[model samples]
Target: MSTYLIGDIHGCYDELQAILEQVNFDSFMDTLWLTGDLVARGPRSLEVLRLIRKLGDSVRIVLGNHDLHLLAVYAGIVRNQLKDSTTLLLEAPDADDLMNWLRCQPVLQVDNQNKMVMAHAGITPQWNIDTALQCAREVEAVLRSDSYPILLNTMYEDMPNHHHWSEELSGLARLRFSTNVFTRMRYCFPNGQLDMICKDMPNKAPEPLRPWFTLPSLIAENYSIIFGHWASILGNATPEGIYGLDTGCCWGGELTLLCWEDKKFIRIPYAGIKHW
Candidate 1:
């Protein structure tokens, strides 16, 4: 009954299977938590989505930026990138079912019993746990609604890149901010506004731009925050209670999994096959 948390899969189905087999994961018993980006960038995104969907109730997932992009592409809100490997998934027989399931997936998941919270990127420092959860629900509601394409469309519209969270923000602006924080955020300004551009490692980041987790926040003091999206970190050492699990498996790095109860990490190296 171990709970396992794996980083971004990014369509690396073979490595995902290898790591799961190495842990002897039993879908009927063991619980698996995924950091999302379940598709794109690898050889077998269709297979990856199928496998995770087949895992059923044994798995928990938070939607990543890539996942949202897949939804937008599926809805014809945006075109699929030439380099994306999700075309097979889009053409699959169950594409509709898979996309519906994915859109219904929340951007944030909290395990009260385990005292942990997970998002694809990470929570903003300006948001307390309650506010974060509320904002997540707001976006999740939109994604799960019939008007979901509206959100998928509006989220990509050219707006101020540095729109800080505010109690007064409403409508599409509010949903977009919440979505970006949950899926695209990496760094924050000293005043707590999101820095969406920089993806460098913390030390190399320009001055005053700190990793979101490094900022002082109420959630960091209370529960372990698990996230992916910044593959540059490559699952390196982070501050206590902060877990950056994306090991860049799609970029020829390793796929990493953490056994939550014991904090043991299991890593499976990429096979170095170029899928894109």
Candidate 2:
């Protein structure tokens, strides 16, 4: 059975289907790993969620920033934006089941046998694999618990901005930092502090800032890391063992799927569907 790692879909259901077909993905045989942002921006958010949810055990997903935002909007903790295409998903008859399924998803997935780790964004440089796993479980517990709305309500702010992880960090502050690292981080200072403002490609980014993967980390030294979120990179080559899969399919680029056994990338260009 082949294992395929797909970049962010962002609600581009048609493109997702096309790429899966192109790869001859078999739900019963091949395993599909998604880099989240499963809904938003593009058309048919509802359909995309439904299809992935139906895939069940064959699919593995880590929640993206957009997926969290969609949950917040569904929980009435935040308002849906005009540019977002998730309203249909929020209003769907199976919205509750879908949201619950999403809430139960983790922020980090590790395949020890393959020595690979997947997160929506890259793992923080400050944390080792064990620490990252612990932090992910911390957030996942809250998300799967009755207190999930509390996290959804308080996680929107970027606190301790541009700061590194601290042992002293506790309560919601700690959870928020972990959440950002797993789902929103892009650039970080050489000292391992996060820099949330810059989204430019590495060369264009101002001095003292480097992509998170460039920073020294125990995790990177070991497992191969697969992530999405930074669509601006357009699937450009990154440091060895680091994979950036988001190719901006929702913004008129291609949807990318990495074939794990052979490390082949199968791309399906956007069909130019108008933004919702």
Candidate 3:
């Protein structure tokens, strides 16, 4: 049996199907790991979510920022942004189930035997793999709790770019920063300040903000990190021991699939859009 890691699907069901065909994915013999953002910014969000849910234990999905946002919106804690693109998802008959599944997903996953970790965004330079998993669990607990709706109400806005963790950051508000740092984060100010605003390449961020992967004395040097959500920058390439899978399938780029154990990659070019 082989494990495959797929990049940000972003609701592109057709592309996902095409890539799965390329890999010859088998439900019984193969397992799929998704880097998150399984829905959003594309046409078939419902279809993709349903397909993944149908896959059940055959798949492991680490939550992405978009997934969290969808949960917030579904719970009525947050309003829809980006031109009501998620409206259809909210109106779906299985919306609650989909939202529940998304909220239950962890922000980080580790395969100790393989010395590998997967998250939607990259890990913080300051955090070792164990600490990152611990932090993700703390948030995951809140997301899974009865207070989740209350937490979602507070999930908006960027938190302070400081590196220190605070216990006072309960529920969704606490998650906002963590999610951004681990999922959407790219660059940061030298002193461990998060540069959440800039989405461009690492070189383009201000001098104070360096890409998280470039920080001095990174902790996860011994393990390989797999992540998506940097489609605009890394595309479907593996850099060093870090794997970036988001090929911007929803934005007219390729959909990427990587075989985790063997490091084999398959990319399906976008016949729909040209650029993300």
What are the per-residue Cα lDDT tens digits for candidate 3 across 1-276? 889999998888888899898888998999899999888887788889999988888998898878877887887777787642677888899888888877887888888877778889888776676667777887788888877776556555654633344545554555666766666777767776667677766656667777776676355567888889888774533458888889888888878999977888898876654333
Clash pairs of candidate 1? none
lDDT of 3 at 40: 81
**Span of ten consecutive residues with least summed lDDT in model 1:** 154-163
| RMSD of each candidate relative to the true structure | 1.4, 1.4, 2.6
Q: Which ten residues in a row have the lowest lDDT in candidate 2?
A: 155-164
Q: For each candidate, what is the lDDT?
A: 0.89, 0.90, 0.77
For residues 1-276, write the lDDT of model 2, one tens digit per residue. Answer: 999999999999999999999999999999999998999998888999999989989998999999999989988899999788777888889999999999999999999988899999989888888999999999999999989999888777765552568878888888888888888999898888888788888999999999988778878467899999999888675888889999999999999999999999999999966563
lDDT, residue 190, candidate 1: 79
Model 2: how far is 209 from its true place, Å? 1.2
Candidate 1 TM-score over all chains jointly: 0.96
Clashing residue pairs, backbone N/CA/C < 3 A, model 2: none
Per-candidate TM-scores read 0.96, 0.96, 0.90
Q: In model 2, which regions exceed 4 Å deviation?
A: 220-222
Candidate 1 residues 38-152, lDDT tens each? 9889888999988998999999999999999999999899999867788888988999999998898889999988999999999898998899999999999989999999999
Worst 10 residues of 3 by lDDT: 161-170
